[model samples]
Target chain A: MSRRPEPVQVVKERRDAALDTLVGGLPYLAFLGIRFERRGDELTAVLPFRDENIGNPLLPALHGGVTAAFLETAAVVELAWSQLWPQMEGGAGAAAPGVRPPLPRTIDFTVDFLRSGLPRDAYARAVVVRQGRRYASVRVEGWQDNRARLFAQASGHFMMPDLSAGPGAAFADDEAMDPAPPASEPR
Target chain B: MSDDQYLRIAQQFIEALPHARVLGLRLLSVSPGHAEIELPWAAHLVGDPATGVLHGGAVSTLMDTCGGAAVMAHPAANAGAATLDLRIDYMRAATPGQAVRARAECLRVTRSVAFVRATASDDDVERPVALMQGAFTLHAPRLAGEAT
Candidate 1:
């Protein structure tokens, strides 16, 4: 019998694959101009400001929704990067056929607007508070110039899939394939 | 000011935000202390492409816009408002191929703050996809003699 890849190795592979396709596979994040930078195991979300992201044109502040969305995406992407397995509804072997890695479902989200987000490059940092068998909790904070001067802080809960339970479990998803072409390319 | 004037202001407020336009949010109607907005579905906005469901962030945008609009339409709000805090509970994923509607009401208004409660649904109002509650910070103080 071929030796099965350890669950930890599988998670690392999945995390690397997700980073490669972070843009094309996730179209919405691209639309919002969200990018990721990984340093060792830490992931930071970068949101470059565009005219479309401005909420208060007068103050030239980023839209509350834009900030919130950035924070939420940061939380989800961080969870995946950390390779925390959420319990799957169907068994691990019951894999769905797709190239895009399965993303956790958001159960609850709360955002606190600490300060108005100025129109500029914004960055978010997310930390997974806890990872249980079926659910995971994450805390994310967004800032512009000074990290201490946080524009927004958020807490969210996501449902994870159990990926370590079965063989071929982690590599079954088509997301294991190379990244897709850019959105501009024809399907 | 009259509700009609406040309604017009609310519409302009929604139009001014480019992100709101990106989501294709339409102002359905507005009355004093209340606002309604609609979001048309698009393929690129889906959070879960496998399931083809709208992303939670899109829903949050819709709800936040409505909540802010409700504050703008409030009679006591002489100036615009900003979101102080917002909470969303995802009851279920929004069905794909359906437009989402969000309606928010300013439950109360004080000198410097306005409270809002809102909901987002696709076809059926009874079975909502998400629920939201938020508070907005009023730019100006309450109008004279306005209800507390």
Candidate 2:
């Protein structure tokens, strides 16, 4: 008889692979050089410092929108991970065909700028405040050197896509459905 | 500040932002209490590969920068301001292969804060891709050539 892998190990591998797929699908995240590190089930979103991220050369601060975007991305990814966890756990071996859940859509996002984002690597973590079948609320906090002194904080509401319908089903009629030729160069 | 001064300041402000340059954000127009910026479509700005739509983050950045420009252009505001809080609502994803433009107006300026309202749209003018409202800290007015 062939040896079988432990259930915990299988779940861990699936979690990592799912996360790669989730984050890899976003071109803007790749453009901004934002990456994720998973420690157990927790995720820390990192925005590596780049000259292009600066808004004010004098103050040498990161762009406010970039900060907000980082927070929002963190929230969205966290919410998606929370939704993915249970499904991955339940269907360990019986993989559901054509059941990739679509990304959650942002309804509204509110960001509070506490301090200027310095020209350094920034980090963010998001917590899902509440997630229902159709809607989710997430709160994210971003910091540079010190987590206690957050540079920015954000709360956002997202419209959860119907997981039963599978990927692309929810956005088929919209402009997002049409796929264009791949760009030759990365912008 | 005079209209010309405001225009010059707005131009200089947008030019000084490195991220704005990276995103190729253009200052289309600026006047007292009003400013307009445009972001051309680029392959790098696409948020979703499946749909070829520009990222909501890119739109957020454009609107935020536009709001700050409007605040700076306001007669009551000074040379520099910082965003205190900003709220953005995604109306819809922007059309692919088209440029997005954001218009912002400084609705009210208090002693220490400036209020701004902004909207972003693509080719379709009737429906906006996103709407933004923000509060910005107002610095004391300074001379054109004054050092920071």
**i-RMSD of all predictions:** 7.4, 5.1
Place model 1 in a CAPRI quality band: acceptable
lDDT, candidate 1, B1-148, per-residue tens: 8867766776777887888988899898998788899999898887756667777888899999999888887889878788989999888767677889999999999989998999998875667888899999997223222377
lDDT of 1 at A72: 96
Runs with alpha carbons beyond 4 Å of true place in candidate 1: A1-16, A84-98, A164-187, B1-9, B140-148
lDDT for B96 (candidate 1) = 77
Candidate 2 per-residue lDDT over residues B1-148, each given as its tens digit: 7767756776777988999988999888998788999999998888767767898899999999999988887878766888989999998878899999999998899979999999999887777889999999985223222377
lDDT of 2 by residue, A31-147 (tens): 889999998779999999999999878767899999999998899889877877777766552135333356787889999998888889999999999998878999999988887
The TM-score that candidate 1 achieves is: 0.80
Give candidate 1's error at residue B137 in angstroms. Answer: 0.3
RMSD of each candidate? 9.3, 6.2
